[model samples]
Target: MERSTPISRRPKAVALTFDDGPDQIWTPRILDVLADYRIHATFMCVGKAVQRNPQMLRRIKDEGHIIGNHTWDHPNLTQLPLSDVQTQVLRTTEEIDRVAGVKTRLFRPPYGDLNDDIVRKVTSLDHEILLWDIDSWDWKGLTGPQVAKNILGHVRDGSIVLQHCAGPTETVKGTLEALPYIIEVLSESGFTFSTIPQLLHLSAYR
Candidate 1:
């Protein structure tokens, strides 16, 4: 039985976002699934991950996926001093620029953890925070079916789904397994997949 929204004729859009990636293993596998589906997504990458896999970051850019700064070490920004927060964002944005020549303006905090100070710091760096409306809970180590159930149960027009490219081994596997089901069910229900920028109609790279 279908788990997504009831079929509608009107056009609707949702975003698929993967975080903490540009890794060798999980990232590529997730990219493969996206490529097979021919859908562009957003990758919110950790700074060190980009440095460790510069070429992977470039490939992600080349493949028409949007990239965002996810911080240097995936710290909770709300817990950091403003100086540290600024450094975290700047370091990652610079790394993305160094690798891909794309000035990404998207930022997503680790664990959806943020506060007013963090928000101000991010915007002061010329980035807009992008959060998800639906979370797959892949990072929590749910199975494929569980991840799929989490997303499909709540996705609707203009939903942004939080997923991950690199996490625990089981997490990535779960996300990978859930992709086909998520994509198919959404498509069947007339929900068009989009990168966050496209879904929000914002300039992706500055």
Candidate 2:
């Protein structure tokens, strides 16, 4: 399936996004890899993870990547009350602001699970909801090469590719291993990596 973003109209552009991060160990490693390629990716961070490693959140910002809210915890917002859903989003947005001094306008629902209520609440808070068209499925115990294959197979111009920076040990390892090849192949194909805000031409922070 082809997914188009407003900014993706540029030829050969794609957004790379990592979910559930600011992890103490893996986040730094992922940053290093991105740095080596001179590319920036968006990180959708859990509020609890950001609180546990605020410095990592700052580092992500300092390094010129975008940080987005992934919720205070990894809850299925579609299953929660509207009030609880609001709390989940706002708390994380506040935590991100408290740590990085910027308010993010991007949100990715946990597990890509959402309903009308979750969308209404997130929209009311002035956030654009982001979901991926190309899933690397690194969380599924695939090898790095396999994950890379999956991503390359499905990606197109204006595609948002999903990978996890924090998860089980194997997931992190596979993502790390797959990233270089993913970058190399995509870059050689004339695809440039972009953050979500950059891709959508939206404000990264309020």
Candidate 3:
């Protein structure tokens, strides 16, 4: 879905977003798990990765998942000049649009570090900035139980979950191991997943 109705007009929901994909190995595996549940998640893709693997980008879109820009290179936007920040976001959006035949309306800053300048630039592009309500810490060397515990501990209505598809070797290992349990717990708890844009409607846009 491109956008969700206003939150007051919509049912309670959460979003699970993965950043820095579509990775050859990790992204596909992640997609499989989400598909098994018939759930949709959003992928914030790096532009160069999308360029290198257009087919994977198509697959993400074809499977009913939304794509968002995470930049051409996953850089700390707070450290870059305004021009660089604009380039990072815009380039990724163009790459995603080219492969998916859709222009994504959401963007997540790499590292979740958004300064006012970067926010203004991203907003100027007409993309909403996505911040997480739940930080699973899958990027940390936490075991499956730990990751599951971390998420379930904080999950609530309209939560946005942060997970990683790209990271240090250790971080990626933790994410892969923890994912199944995380999905199962949230699914059992009567929560449904959607993309960032889908989670943020008029009533919940704050």
lDDT of 1: 0.86
For model 2, residues 1-206, the per-residue Cα lDDT tens digits are 33322344546888999999888899999999999999999999999999999999999999999999999999988888999998998999999999999898899888888877788889999988888888888888899999999999987778898889888898889999999999999999989988887777888888
lDDT of 1 at 23: 90
lDDT of each: 0.86, 0.88, 0.76
Q: In model 3, how large is the Cα lDDT of residue 169?
A: 62
Candidate 3 C-alpha error for residue 105, in Å: 1.3
lDDT of 3 by residue, 71-162 (tens): 89888888999999988888887778778888777777877887777878898988777767678777776776777787788877887778
lDDT of 1 by residue, 38-153 (tens): 99999999999999999999889999999999999999788889999999989998999999998889888888887788888789989988877778878889999999999999
User: TM-scores across all candidates?
Assistant: 0.93, 0.95, 0.88
Q: After superposition, how far is residue 89 of candidate 3 from its true place, in Å?
A: 1.2
Name the lDDT value of residue 44 in candidate 2.
Answer: 95
| Candidate 3 TM-score to native | 0.88
Highest-scoring model, TM-score: 2
| Superposition error at 140 for model 2 (Å) | 0.8
- Which stretches of model 2 miss by more than 4 angstroms? 1-8
